[model samples]
Target chain A: MAVYTEVTDEELSAFIAQYDLGAVLSCKGIAEGVENSNFLVVTERGPYILTLYEKRTRKEDLPFFLGLMEHLAEKGIACPLPVAGRDGVALRELSGRPAVIVTFLAGMWPRRISPQHCAQLGEALARLHLAVGDFRMERPNALALNGWKDLFAKSAERADEVAVGLRTTLADELAALEANWPADLPAGVIHADLFPDNVFFRGDSLSGLIDFYFACNDFLAYDIAICINAWCFEIDGSFNATKARLLLANYRKVRPLSRAELDALPWLCRGSAVRFLLTRLYDWLNHPPGAFVRPKDPLEYLRKLRFHQSVRGLGDYFLDDSATGEA
Target chain B: MAVYTEVTDEELSAFIAQYDLGAVLSCKGIAEGVENSNFLVVTERGPYILTLYEKRTRKEDLPFFLGLMEHLAEKGIACPLPVAGRDGVALRELSGRPAVIVTFLAGMWPRRISPQHCAQLGEALARLHLAVGDFRMERPNALALNGWKDLFAKSAERADEVAVGLRTTLADELAALEANWPADLPAGVIHADLFPDNVFFRGDSLSGLIDFYFACNDFLAYDIAICINAWCFEIDGSFNATKARLLLANYRKVRPLSRAELDALPWLCRGSAVRFLLTRLYDWLNHPPGAFVRPKDPLEYLRKLRFHQSVRGLGDYFLDDSATGEA
Candidate 1:
């Protein structure tokens, strides 16, 4: 863990002094992440996560991450609400790192996920999309359609050595996406990395969500596609059709996807694959080591890229539309 | 870039104090990597990379990563050779981070990878395996066969959400693997993350190997299986038969695999897929807010896992060996 920030018990208790919900008690470092230093704070008050900023994070961006949580919390989105300090500020300086405090979510990450959970995730994700649409702030998708090309350019000089065909494929895909990019659809800020860990739950009911770093403006349906790739799969690398259906149906219960979005799911999934593959490929080629940060496996994205290359339809990835009652 | 260590001009001059290599020159940050910070050091001595240790590394393990580079460089491998500092130590520390200086490598990562490049990589990887046989060091395969279960356990609660039959299928594989784990294969340290990014080349020849964080003890043949999954496919995810053949055949030239090893590729590939999928799943569930790190696409592993699920012969993947050539 990277200790991006340092905070003390007295300061924390003082910070949360005004919040009527919990009593202040103890605080200690939990884990250090690339973006923030996380401390587990136990208050006679309650449990909260104290985060101090790291190098990669700019203090200016804290409000977006913090305020979004507060906004979502008010909307019944089941996320942590940013608690303000004594001066009514949501952030503070600790260990020379930007710091903030938020409530800790409950629920163990599902290890042996069931297809039902996949379906539920899909539904819950749809709900998230609907709920957050009303939030006042907006952020454009930083990793939207053309992001892959920029990453490729960053590593293109050495693309040939990584593999012979990668360059040509990247070029071709860039062209294909450009030519076929979606122009109009439901738009909103999305929790782009809506995989299992970011979501917390108590039993079958969701408790909260964490990690809003990748949250940005993008297609509403694309977020669902990300969920399909993330939530509807088991640890064994197998896709569960039932769970995928459950997910889709659940989403429909909230804000139904438009036909354009529904029709675009397959292509969007491909884009999703491309997005991750490029980043993974970039990291692999660069091998930039950081403090306490581990490079993820690029092969997984490679496999996904390949699978999407051979995709026939979104139905194949999900099940038939009959999956959800909306069909 | 995190400056883990620095050899100021004065320090370099004093150290070379004795060596008379060249002029103390400019040190600049290199734009590469998601993990460690690197600098391109230009001295009358030549160009080198000054790396700062970050989070996912232990300084003590430098011997393994650095020594492997030396051993490979000594054997005509075109890789960075760890240079000793003024104190005659191969490593130095700056900014409280472990640091090392290495020669800069030149090459382009292949964009349109050809069968030839794949074949060459296969051959080169084989040579690497052979060279490491006498590594004179021992490191456990931290992510090998049985280790996948622990990763799955780390996030199995949501396993069912992935695929319908994933849980049961994994259960059966776990039992089968446990009951019939291969023990009598050629064992050695392997570059487990031998994906395209790790290998650099000028044209079709490999130039350097960077990032050895995942290298560990495991069956050498398993490494080959990993290569097939990585090198045998096109960017669009299609399996290139010729590429697969070239990779396998060239690999065999340096390290001929036994029948038992051949039979184990499917299981090994499956295990590899499982290993990556589990790690990726864990990351997906646990991303930190505002981290620059991008999560890998789990679908790729899902596809690879599916392919391995149905494997019945070497032919199924792409191995047709004859006494003379690849059958």
Candidate 2:
């Protein structure tokens, strides 16, 4: 819930004049996306999202995020298409920040994660992976293995303030993940942060995926692991294997997973859990008093990490019979 | 910038099912209106604002607020008309709070106010005063003279914390306003909070007025005082008399102001200043640590009150020659 930048009427009119979108009807600051200021801009043409990238999103990375959305949409994936100006440039400056207007997608993100939602999400996730296979842009996941260690270092001294043994637990997990991280797997562009809120749905079908700030080139199975942790968990800290089975099975129907990718699922899931835990821990310890956004509970990820640590093999995620006829 | 209530997809669908607004296509929480949870809901029929009344708005007052909007819109005023459900009821319950869908007005509030904006605002305000002359429902202003005492009582002990001698100054001002507040001077329904943000404009023309929760039965001149304090002050605490002259002159073109209302303007402006000062002081003192909405600086109103206290008559607001053409 953020609108960090305030766009004035004159500045907005001048900005919109660069585009073919008709006279501005209304532009409202929307309470979505924490990384930038977002406005639900309506014009004589229709509704579009005008985003002003803030300091959190590096200016150099705007091309990759904007280009990835364009490439994915051109490949028939359901996502917001960046609307370029009359000069054919999608990215421009507004209020001294990098800005762009993208066509608005129509759907509400599912608050209650149903098995059907997981199935739809699984298919969309696989399709996004396959769509971006040939795209030339490449951005390494900044919050990957090395980034986790850096975040832990920043929060390690005060980690125990959140939980009594959280500091030691994170140290041990970091060492274990460092030694056992997978060497090679099917790699492509992955939506590194595919939380349920980022995936919108219309009824039982997936409508679109959004917020590509964290999208990067990484192990595709790692994206699946992130989803299993995000969508397959209940409020009470229990994992629903049925949802996981549907997600994995539906994903495999579109793109088959290699044997090694299947075997590395547990480690990838654990790494995913630790990645979130470290970031949340860092935020929890550092968020200023009276901050607008309440930092999420880091212990939730700790609980998820414990579950993934206890997993014996792929069987723990779902029964072997659930994967019948799959690679 | 608030969306305090989270309406689920199922809850939203069920709520919209009560209306003729077609199947819900999208609903996004908008950062508008501090008092209620506002959503920009787009359906097959287009856009509307689905507002879930929060705790700050009393449930019992819902009928007066909703009916007033309906009444004003029917009288040809440019405002959001309340949309009734199929059952002919405009008010219903959503997320355990009284909710309603209002026709979406297409305009943006002026971020930088110009004298032309003030002129248009004055005309719209006078039209609003005339439109509500015959409305049946009545609600006394909750933040009027008596309410100011209650709010000061809550913050008197700490008023000095905001500024030296503030407590004594407030106590003396309250006594003076109690002695001088006009009686029997053009009373009717008044939009007591006509801040610039509540008025919308398209280019140079006034499009509509909104946030009617502050509407109530009060001295019509008091509404003018509120607007004077809101729209006539520059960001640097200086008053713009040219804008004030344009506002009052244009307003009189629609509905003439009585000589009594004109003479009472200075004291009414002082009272309006105290009204906001006490509420802001109370909020500043009582707000919990880490509150989401930062309490506004009470000193801003203190400066405005000081300026109004120094004014000798309407001449200080604008040249008397400016009102020569009007009553």
Candidate 3:
């Protein structure tokens, strides 16, 4: 929950004047998105989300994020369309920060993830991969395999403060992932952080995907691995193969995975786990005392990493028969 | 900025089932109102504010706050009307706390207060006083004179921690206020916490008043005193008598202030200062480490109290000659 920047009334009016979105009716700071200040701005025209990019999001990377959303949206993907000003410039400035307004999507993110939600998410994820096939913009995933060691270095010294043996465990995992990371796979733009909170649903159907701040060019199969870790895990740390089967089966229906991509799933999942674990560990160790956002538990991803380390093959994730049949 | 309660989608849907508001389209936790979990709930019907009362707000007081808003709205005062469910009940349970949905008001609180904003606030405040004259429900101001000593006792030991001699200063001021507080002045339902954030404006006009949880029966002049301290102070701890003059002058145009009420202004302002000072001091000293909502600066009110201490009479706040003319 964050609203790091407070937009003054004068600043807001001047900012809104750039757009065709009528007189401002109300602009409220919304408790969403941890990295940026978000306002649910209502105007004479309609509701839109005005986001002021905070320091965490590099200014240079905003064009790729906004352009990716625009690109995917044009390809018939369900996502927030960046609303440009009268001059047709979507990216602008507000309160001394890079700002943009996007059309408000109507749906609530599923708090209790159901198998149906996983099914819908799988199809949508595959569609998103297919949609970005023709997009020209490219941004390498900054938190991918290449960045894990650097991230771990910052938190390694105090890792054991969170749990005993955590430092050694992370070091070993980082070495293993760095040595075995896959290079040959179907690559495209992937929603690197497609947690349940970022995917919204209206009833049983997927409504939209949001928060493209982490979108980047990476192995598309790795995106599925991220989803399997995010969606298939229960609160008690047990894996639900049924949800994984549905997610993978539905995803393959839209875009068939190559044989090599299927074989690399375990390693991708482990890499995905390390990516989150390292970031979460850094945040856990470094978050300011009395910070509004409670840093996510890094150990949860550690548990996921352990599960991935134990996996013998694809059979450990989903039944081969279920993959052939209807999910 | 707060969203203490995390309402699950299942719980939210079940809660909305009790209402005729169309299917839940979206519900985003908003960073507003420190005392409750507020969501900008948009449905098929329209937008509304779904507030889940936090622990700071007593369960028994829900009826008074909701009822007062309903009463005030019916009396033609622009405020959020508590929306009743299908069963004609506005108050219900959500996420195991008292909750109510109120019609959304469309306006933003002035981030930079101007004299015109003060004038609008003055007229709106007077109208609110007149509108609530017939309100049947009565709640004594819990943070008023009778409650200050007990509040001070909670923080007296550490008062000086905030500033040198603050403990003695508060103790002596409490005693003096207890001795001088007026007994026979105009009394009615007062929005005791009519801070700038609680009042909404569209351009230069007052659109509505909100956050009625602090509404209670008190001397009407004391409400003006609260506004004087809130809307008439500059950010640098300097008092703007021009803003005060515009506020009080416009307020009298709607409901004339009695000579006695005018005479009691200084003491009322001082008492109002103490009321906030003790509460803020208590919050400052008692808030848990790493709490999300930052405790407001108690010293700001200390400065305001000091300013009120130096004022000799109404002349110090405003010119009496301007009271009869246009603000």
For model 1, residues A1-327, the per-residue Cα lDDT tens digits are: 344444443445455665554654334344323446676555555456777777766567677778788878887887777778656787777656777778766543454466656666766677778778778787667687767778878877776666677778777877887787688888887889877667655445565677786788888888887877776655555667777777777778777666677777777877887787687677777755433455565556656656666767766775555423483
**On a 0 to 1 TM-score scale, where does candidate 2 land against the true structure?**
0.98
lDDT score for residue A226 of model 1: 81
Q: Which regions of candidate 2 are displaced past 4 Å?
A: A319-327, B321-327
**What does candidate 2's lDDT look like per residue over A194-313, in tens digits?**
998899888778999999999999999999999999999999999999888888888888988877888888999999999999988888888888777767889999999999999898
Instruction: Give the DockQ of candidate 2.
Output: 0.78
TM-score of each: 0.48, 0.98, 0.98
Count of clashing residue pairs in every prediction: 76, 0, 1
Error of 1 at B193 (Å): 36
Kept native contacts, fraction for each prediction: 0.00, 0.82, 0.85
Which tens-of-lDDT digit does each residue in A1-327 have in candidate 3? Answer: 879999987799889999999999889999977899999998988889999999999999999999999998899999999999999999999999999999999898988889899988999999999999999999998898668888888888999999899999989888888788887888999999999989998877899999999999999999999999999999999999888888988898898887788888999999999899899999989999878887889999999999999998888776453334344
Model 1 TM-score, all chains together: 0.48
TM-score of the second chain, each candidate in turn, equals 0.86, 0.97, 0.97
- Please provide TM-scores computed only on chain A for all of the candidate models, following their numbering: 0.87, 0.97, 0.97
* Ten contiguous residues with the weakest lDDT in model 3 chain A: A318-327
Q: What DockQ does predicted model 1 obtain?
A: 0.01
Please give, for residues B1-327, the per-residue lDDT of candidate 3 as tens digits.
879999988888889888999889889999877889999998888889999999989989889999899888889999999999999999999989899999999999999999999888888999999998888999988888779999999899999999999999999999899899998999999999999999998877889998998888999989999999999999999999888888888899999988788888899999999999999999999988867888889999999999999988767766573334354
* Tens-digit lDDT track of model 1 for B19-44: 33464343434334546766554455
State how far residue A304 of model 3 sits from its true place (Å). Answer: 1.4
